[model samples]
Target: MTHNSIRVHYGKRVVAALFGLAVAWGTPVALAEPVDAANQYLGVWNYDQPDRADATDIATVGQFGINPLTFPQVGTIEFTRGRDGEIIGHTDQGCTWHFRVNGDALDLTSTDQYCFNNVIGSGYNTYSWHVTVRDGREQEVVRANSYLGYGTFDFELTNGKRTRADAAGPGDAARLFTGTWMFDPTNPAYLNNLTSPGYQPKTGAVRIDSNGTGLIARTDDGCTWTLDARGNTAELAPAGQTCARSDGTVTMAFWSMSSDGTHVYTVLNSTDPQLGSYFIGSGSLTRQP
Candidate 1:
């Protein structure tokens, strides 16, 4: 081939290789995965007290007895991992740390030691961040060492109350409460695996007025209840026999919803208390005519 023709062919091959490289690199940049829109930080996160064998062990698990907890002391422990497999955590108290995965949960120890490295040697001071994510949110109750006994430790993630989920007076509370709700009377059973001795699994409906002050709830067994803007813990009383043919009355208190209004949770203290006292419950409800 002529020298000029050889030079031109070589130049063309270089341009083609560069073009292919650009397309290969640019495709991934153009089609990156969408960020997860779920703000896991928004909803309430609860964990039960871990069943520790002793007080010293409890300290190791990082439990301080029944006082107001700080973000570091209490609240969700956000986990962050690095590309190199290093791990870190952020908690409500604004504290950050290196963590190790102990099974399904996290163990937040001092930054000095490594998780896999410590599996065989001397023990160090550390706290357990035993938690589970449910419904895309972390549960507050965590088991520090083992799951055995209960502790008096309970926490609210709203920081110091009046969270966006809290009753923002009548206006906001009403807007949130006004919705169409279908009761899956079986949900609690599904979670706890316990059934009431006499009650059948029946469904129901609830309608909240826009004024944020009225409620009309009906049971599938043919019972109803009406509500007016009244108290913090409103009684979910049955209107009459037509409303509830069942054995006991239903009561609800501390009603609240997430910022997105997609999920609703309440502290329902049933006379029967289906699962137990202080039943923390949730349901899927949406706005409607």
Candidate 2:
């Protein structure tokens, strides 16, 4: 299957603008205390590099490719303040990390030892996260040194203006999908393997207003799209371009929000002969706070 690059010019512009604003605002205050930086880490963060293992060839060396020891290749990491004042880090894959801010960085250790062993590895492994707020956006750098190997991941997240999951009401469903959603390029579940080398996930957002009409933004190759919402389902399509499968069949994009509105299940199905008769891209999106 021949893959076409989606122009991501819009996302680039937004980042450039925000970076300028951050610079104009002067140097961000360096929080020497991890506890003091807790508030800065509160919110949902999307991975800047969705293809986790793509960072280095060694990443694909062993079971590492299929079994990553870090957060899912392409998903969201949500940080929230626990009732006890400890910071909680939640991954879309169902693992939770209890964070202790030690100044400039967070010391993360799994709360669910079982889930931790399953995703990361067995035995003791520690994760460190360093967060920096530029302008109004947040950037996180995570490093893990475990038996699997040492790896580092970076994330650049936009402020999605969302409340904590527990505080969200049912009515927020209509507005729940209104944030950035990314495709995991390395997740085999999200690609049509037979037809292409790999599908590059598009990074974008669903901007919904009170009036209910908004556009879907993709940052890969800068493709403009729009979205229509009805209840919990959102239908996405190219704004003015043609979206046809390899077999000449038209394609459509849609996403279904989970009941709690914290997760979004997405599907983009198309057809391609070499890539297979159908190209179905499936993944999850986490709401940003």
| Best-fitting candidate, scored by TM-score | 2
- Number of clashing pairs per prediction, in order: 16, 9
What TM-score would each prediction reach against the true structure?
Answer: 0.31, 0.34
Report the C-alpha lDDT of model 2 over 43-150, residue by residue, as the tens digit: 765433232334410122123344432222333458888866578878644467787665665555442232343322223333445555555454554444334334
Summarize candidate 1's per-residue lDDT along 1-289 as a digit string, tens digits.
9999999999999878877887988842234687433323333232222222322112222236433322211123345663444356543323455654445544444424312211111123223344344454343322222111343233222211112222235554355455676544444422221223333343456555543345555434454555433212122323111222356554432222222343333322233324232323323333345
Query: Candidate 2 at 236: error in angstroms?
Result: 12
Q: How close is candidate 1 to the true structure, as a TM-score?
A: 0.31
How accurate locally, in lDDT, is each candidate?
0.36, 0.43
